[model samples]
Target: MKSCREATRLMSESQERRLQLREQASLKLHLAMCAPCRNFGKQLSILRGISKSYAEGGPERTED
Candidate 1:
């Protein structure tokens, strides 16, 4: 079993690149029992959506 720290690192890395099969399997197994990591994964998805929208010109930022 992977510790939450390792699992979370793998989870973050997965966002940028594909994880190995064993690593994916381990992350899946850990997330199956870990609520916090699962929530983190959801948050990552939300962030990705928001970022995509921003990249596509959904909004503009201005200096205060």
Candidate 2:
């Protein structure tokens, strides 16, 4: 099993390009078993989507 550090690294790296089949398998296995890492991945995906929205001027988020 991959360590959290390694898993996180792979997660980040995946943003840039496609991972190999082995890497994909390892990351999937790790994310399945690691709740924290799974949450981290979810949050990362959300943040990325929000970032794209901001860049595209999709909407303004009012601060209160």
Candidate 3:
């Protein structure tokens, strides 16, 4: 089993590049058992989406 630190690193690296099959398996297994890591992964995805939206000019704001 991978430690939380290792699992988090793999999750981050996966954003930049494709992980090996073994790495993918390990990360999947870790996430299955670790709630915190799973939440972190979800947050990472949300942040990435927000960043992409911002890069694309984001949503329009109206004066209230």
lDDT by residue (1-64, candidate 2, tens digit) is 9999999999999999999999999999999999999999999999999999989997968989
Q: Count the clashes in each prediction.
A: 0, 0, 0
Mind giving the per-residue lDDT tens digits that candidate 3 earns over 1-64? 9999999999999999999999999999999999999999999999999999999999998999
Ranking by TM-score: 3, 2, 1
The TM-scores of all predictions, comma-separated, are 0.86, 0.88, 0.91
Candidate number of the best lDDT = 3
Q: Highest TM-score, which number?
A: 3
Q: What is the lDDT of residue 33 in candidate 3?
A: 98
Task: Assess each prediction's global lDDT (C-alpha) against the native.
Answer: 0.94, 0.96, 0.97
In model 1, residue pairs whose N, Cα or C atoms come closer than 3 Å (at least 3 residues apart or on different chains), thus clashing, are: none
Q: Is candidate 1 or candidate 2 better by lDDT?
A: 2
Give the better candidate number (2 or 3) by lDDT. 3
Deviating ranges (above 4 Å) for candidate 1? 59-64
Error of 2 at 50 (Å): 0.8
lDDT of 1 at 61: 85
